[model samples]
Target: MPDNSSYLVVPSSVLWLLGFAVVSISILIIATMVLRARRLRSGMHAAGATEPTGSLLPEFEKNGQSAAASLVQWSPETLRHILAKELPDAQVIVVSNREPYIHNRKGDDIQLVVPASGLVSALEPITRACAGTWIAYGGGSADRLVVDENDRVEVPPDSPSYTLRRVWLSEEEQQGYYLGFANEGLWPLCHIAFTRPIFRASDWESYEAVNRKFADTVVAEARNERPIVLVQDYHFALLPRMIRERLPEAIIITFWHIPWPNSEVFSICPWREKILEGLLGSSIVGFHTQFHCNNFIDSVDRFLESRIEREDSAISYGGQISLVHAYPISIEWPPAHLGKLPDVAQCRRRIREKFGLAEDVKLCVGVERLDYTKGILDRFDALDELLKLHPEWIGKVALLQIAAPSRGTLPAYQQLYEECLHRADDINQRYGREGYTPVLMVTEHYSQVQVYEIYRAADVCMVTSLHDGMNLVAKEFVAARDDEQGVLLLSMFAGASKELLEALIVNPYDAATMGDALLQALTMSQEEQRQRMQRMREIVRDNNVYRWAGSMLLDAARLRKRVAVDRAVGAAPAAPGNVISLLDRKRVAAL
Candidate 1:
């Protein structure tokens, strides 16, 4: 009121200042976003530099509206070329529960650590075959990623891998997702042992959220017209459908790393139909064994009650959707060359010293993750019973039990660990004479080299999974033992049992059976062990991991037949100077 003219001037100046502040704030925010985007782009670019990209996919519509069978018979190379074309800018995104490469981010730099997955050995060839990108979620907060000496992010060709973002679960979320959903529910349910599965809505909700995050990542990474996405295992079961909805044109492939139970067992899942539909959304679904594939097909038909036409290698449902057939897994045998290394000999000696073993004790080794499903308790009980029944041979033979720690956070796993420890202690207490503990039980995990050495030195290799998708360990042990000397005591329940029938089979659930099998194996003539090992090795060597991968792709290609056709159309009108005919065909070629 005292100075009207001066007040008006002050108000105008204040307005201008406010406007400037708002503009500055907006600029800063935009700058931050730009920097973040650049960082993400740069990371992807580095990973993709070595990959192949282009529109190599066949225009299926242009391929004469052929049926699924006709499509499979197409030349493998041609089909891959077509697929490569479709994914012209194919950024191979490999999404899994575990990170493909563990990045140790320290300030402005990053260090990558790769895990020792047997799957890697089988898929590495395909990864190396194609140019692609890779993404993955790494080990949980505590366990550091296990890196190999190679210092390379090992992956297949025609694939780019990257990790999906997981909201580093709080302690509560972890319990619900890992403990409640994965272990308590899916773990037991999938194994057809439903007594332990406890249904929880909240835990399942968390699992859904986690899988959605993975879907979001795939949607964000995939290009509009040319994206082929591959999802691994059960952790992200709903991801295929989620991504399918967003990227309708993209080709999705889902591979189940675990066994899919039959109708009777699968019915227990509260969301069984949802899982089946989620998988069905993919253009292709792959399983480790034919039985698993058949089980999945049965689930879809029984639950969905959908009309399915089963062909030789594939199943066509409702004509529009085709569920392709064939097995898609193999073991990475650490080649014969590995045996020649000086370090190999050294590792064997180290294994002997670490366990304090004498040269004469016939070492029978069982190396497995310390999980309840591994039948570790049964193994211990069997060993105990064996020693009790046959006291004379106690010191003559040692069961080298290497129980590698896995999923220790879960209560069930922890209980298993405690039980294992107690069993080991009891055996040592009962059997100890002067120094040697009959059961050389190792709770800690050894390096891959050490494991290889253990496999080489053992007179017998044991695979005793209660319910396994495919115990590649059985195959791996056989591959490593080129001498074909070790007798393999395989569990009848394991998927590997279907493939490895020559080995000594035992019902892991029955301690008596296991003990008997063990005794038979121990006393088994050296010649018989060699013969069985030889036959198993031949099968593993001949089929090989490389052949397994190639077979899948080949089967996919073989879905349809390829007929020689001209680049230009015959009956249809040609554009201006470009006239062509189907009659002007070249000789058909094999892929």
Candidate 2:
């Protein structure tokens, strides 16, 4: 008791020193945090992650005019104001599932890294060159930014002209909708694997809920002006209807990247009607080929009992009031047209040497992503049949199948990979010399240059997809063949096959047809191969990806102009102006 007070009370000099030390530590921490924040902002700026603000459009003046008034009632003035500022002039937002870059951890922080793939080439410059807005979710490597529930990764000001937004999905929402329903249920079914489709009531509900959430996100993000919303693929089919309901004036354009099966096959799915109605909500629907467009129209007609207004260039749903057209999406070939480098020749030589082929041996190549619909097994069977039917060509020629690894997460894909391995082994064992394996199969993806090498060296290019939207690989192969000594034996079922009639078309399921076609292609004269390949190059070169994108945008813009004119003339009474005409929030909420 006597010494307690003295012990508790420190000397004034000691107390002062302790206080100074604490303040110095506090200052250092604050300084370090400030420096860290500045670095983060710089990083975000470099990665093109800044939020878009103010008028995004320069051509249109901000004088309280609405861009979408002709299409729909511009009720919300804020949406109109934002659209006047954000569209057609500022950076155009190209929304996708994944962000452009991947992020890595650095001692409680994260760093962004770009993916080395064809996607990078496809998206990077397209996004960077645009002076419009880009609204995309933080996918892949960019997911690291949302490490904390409360913390938000700031988008820096000096970032690229693109405005990338986040549609961060909760864990439950992702598992139930994305993994469970979208992948397991719709993905397999859409690809025409009816037996494999895993349907669940709960999954359907989750998917609907997620669709509603996505609609909410788009409605919240989109301006009320004429925002050209180019929605991509089947994953967001429901989004079109949602967007149409919310932002009816927005010019919504959708492109289906996958194959559209005929009503006979497409009708197998329980969600067929829902999918069709969802797609019809868009102003324009694009398909890779005429057959796919026809299939879509046929499906809508049969399933929904809907009338179709068929025109020479386009087809319109009678009741839905949406247009469907074939765009035949393609790759950019002008870069390749610039001139071949010396490395291309060297690359071809290197690929031939690496594959351990005799200088005179003919190479028949088929490159594809390792998916069930790609007909990997059937192609192998056809190859086996060819080798068995004609023993003379076994050692003389080889089948080089480049099955690129994709969707390995799916059990069906894993099983297909295993089947491929087994078949490759069986073929080699059945028809192999002391040092020569008859079938030269590789189960890995090649670099773009490597792919170019295969295309150049290949005597015959084979695209045997059971179902494919538009096999760009077929076009790529044709484009790279500067020598024009490549015979393309393509599948009739593929959407590209209709466009590439010059190629020797065969049914993938019909073994006799495929075998006969492959053998004929192998024996075809160099002149014939060159002639066929030249025609294909002409078709692809004329209808490149640039043309595809430009055509869609121009078409939609033109349609919007007509609608605008009609609105001005009072011919379009559907879209009445004034917010008061719109159903109140409470009434809308009830619906």
For candidate 2, lDDT tens digit of each residue in 392-489?
Answer: 88887788888888767768778888888888899899988775776787877565656777777788888888777777778777878767777888
Per-prediction TM-score, please? 0.73, 0.73
Residue 41 displacement in candidate 1 (angstroms): 48
Residue 11 error for model 1, in Å?
Answer: 99
Where is the poorest 10-residue window by lDDT in model 2?
A: 49-58
For model 1, what is the error of residue 6's alpha carbon versus the real structure, in angstroms, after optimal superposition?
Answer: 99
Q: 1-591, model 1: which lDDT tens digit per residue?
A: 476765535587899999999999999999999899755533322211100111111322343332232223222243346445533445555566665444566655554444446555444434444444344544443223333332124332124432233224456666776677877888877774324777799989877877777677677656563365657777777887788667754556677777788888889889898877777666567776666777888888788855454422233332224343435355654453355544434546676787788777778898887877778778878887788898877887788888888878777778888888888889888987775777777887565556677888887887888888777778878887766677899997776776677999888888887887888888999799888988887666545555444443432332221111221333332110001211111112112
Clashes of 1: 47
Best by lDDT: 2
* Model 1, runs deviating above 4 Å: 1-91, 103-113, 140-175, 193-195, 311-320, 324-328, 333-347, 556-591
